[model samples]
Target: MTSRSAPDRLLSVLAAFDHAHPALTLTDISRRAGLTLTTAHRLVGELARWGALERDASGTYHVGLRLWELAALAPRGPALRQVALPYLEDLYEATHENVQLAVRDGGEVVYTEWLSGRSSVGVHIRVGARWPLHATGVGLALLAHGDPGFQEEYCAGPLASFTPYTITEPELLRRTLAEVRRSGVAVSDRQVTPDALSVAAPVRGPDGTVTAAVSVVVPHSGARVPALTPALRLAARGISRALGWHPPTPVPAEDT
Candidate 1:
């Protein structure tokens, strides 16, 4: 929960409905949030009244527009997505592939926006989707730019593999992260899905810290990694600039 008061229990109920389980019955929410049915009912009622949750005709609750509006205020969420949308659109237009924007939320990457192109490969990724640190291109880009301690802990993981190409080894994952940092971009070839490939570049903030990532996913067999890097990097830089990152001032020349 964002806060740790009695209301946190209710907020936790709201938090539990993400991309994976966008719609849940009261019982489902109660079990998932580890709250008793009575507690769940009470909290859900409060949140529904507050416009944070909405009950559908079938009695299942989904996240309400109110919460989505609140999440929009988060600088790392919709704020960033808004600044990046045009560039994201350009990338999608150029490649005719799936484009996405994501941020590091703890050890996972949460996709905030996605644009699917007509000819793109079939990918299960959706808005609000979450993926582990080592599984997808955007996830790897965020993980590679994260704090060292967190990176170490994540690398020492029982890494989940979505496909045979997923890097499940700690040492190998470390090396790959190093490469991504050095090259300023990441690529996942059939790592998350057998028929898809993704290339991602880190989006920086005003202070030059990596704040988000942008990526494009295409069909694995016909993907052109070499040609796609420039487009991805251009979009990343555009988003960073929109977020107020100015080019570093070049040092003055010495006296002649």
Candidate 2:
């Protein structure tokens, strides 16, 4: 059997922690990282000392602040969040709905920021939650603006269904992406959940490439897509502008 390299072994240990399993014991890490108890203990000790993991009084280890400090340096994660937070806050204040900022990573959208009021409809989204590209508004906006070849490949792959309304057909998903591109806004009605709807618009970088997405999720029963589209578009434009994107003249300013 070929042995794993040192970097691979270390990363495997870190990969054991996710949104679902934030804390773990030594045995859990050993099992999940596919390492023997001795190896896991050695690596865990190194990581904890280096501040990548922290152990509590109960001997359960959680991600440490040092990792967070490093994660902040990632341009798409905390850096994007810092630039988009004001616009997200504005959208949340205006609509009093759940607002989010996300960027595409592989076939999924990774949410970077989330804000919601105490009375807003509840959703299964958090700061780092991931969702499929065809099943959420932000995901649609990002996927629609993605490279055409990659988009086609993603559309042709298996589409997971969270609700009956999710776009499962490749042709239909292609059509939806086209519409999102044409309209500069993507509306997801009961796609992620039966009772929730989201309206999203793409946020662009300095070169006008779609870099991220901003959205507001509200209850599906009285969702006002027509009313929400304008505000959502404006917020997206504001974020794009802050990111150094100069909206083109022939195209509408809101499409940036």
Task: List RMSD in Å for every model shown.
Answer: 4.6, 1.7
Tens-digit lDDT string for candidate 1 (44-140): 9989999989999999999889987888898877888889999999988888888999999988899999998865687777787788879889999
Local distance difference test, candidate 1? 0.87
Top candidate on lDDT is: 2
lDDT of 2 by residue, 1-256 (tens): 0389999999999999998899999999999999999999999999999999999999999999999999999999999999989888889889988999999999999998899766978886888889899999999999999999999999996999999999899999999999998898999999999999999999999998999999999999998998999998999999999999997878774344
Candidate 2, which segments miss by more than 4 Å at Cα? 253-256
- Model 1: residue 64 alpha-carbon error in angstroms: 2.3
- CA deviation > 4 Å runs, candidate 1: 1-5, 15-21, 24-42, 57-60, 249-256
Ten-residue stretch with the least lDDT total in model 1? 247-256
Note the Cα lDDT for every prediction shown.
0.87, 0.93
Give the deviation of candidate 1 from the true structure as CA RMSD.
Answer: 4.6
